[model samples]
Target: MNNVMGIALSGMRVAQQGVQVAAHNVANLATPDAQRLQLKRSAVEQGGVQASVTPAGVDAAAQLGDLLAAKAEVVAFAANATVIRRQDQMLGSLLDREA
Candidate 1:
């Protein structure tokens, strides 16, 4: 059951990360330097999955390291979903303006 718990925990953690990266992207939508932060995930060989966030233009690494620190993760959880949504709106607006 421990392994199952680990898997569950990992899944939750990864989902949270996804929401977080999106939030970051949204938060920076107005920032000229922001390039859409994206969250990357990799399956753990043994139990669960791991997640990391990087710029949209970055190449996907086949692996995820200890990139997200504990404090960062907490903040990410706080605003990730909202950030991503905002970013999406901003992107759409920019595209519409161009069109």
Candidate 2:
């Protein structure tokens, strides 16, 4: 359904933002007084998900944990995308058969 696609797309965007935040943290590792950033997730009132970036402070261990979590998020995003693709393909096949 369209809602499913919207949710999956939002999830992908969150995962992408998380990956970007992790990369930024790694890039600024050597910079003095650098603040680590993280993506915060929330459900949309209309029935989807959304994310916002926030400062997480400067803790290396926490940042590492966040990076690992972000990797898992990326995996989840990939799985969702695959499901969406398969669903689209199945719908197309059904339409073709009907035609």
**Model 2 Cα displacement at 91 (Å)?**
1.3
Instruction: Tell me the number of clashing residue pairs for each predicted model.
Output: 5, 0
Task: Give the residue spans of candidate 1 off by over 4 A.
Answer: 58-99
lDDT of 2: 0.80
Off by over 4 Å in 2: none
Q: Which candidate has the top score in lDDT? A: 2
| Candidate 2, 44-89: lDDT as tens digits | 9866688899988656497577668768878978987996898799
lDDT, residue 26, candidate 2: 75
Candidate 1, 1-99: lDDT as tens digits = 346556656766776776566566556555767576667789999967788877676434411322343345656444545554565677789889999
- Residue pairs with colliding backbones in model 1 are 20-80, 22-84, 23-83, 23-84, 26-87
Residue 57 in model 2: shift from native, Å? Answer: 2.7
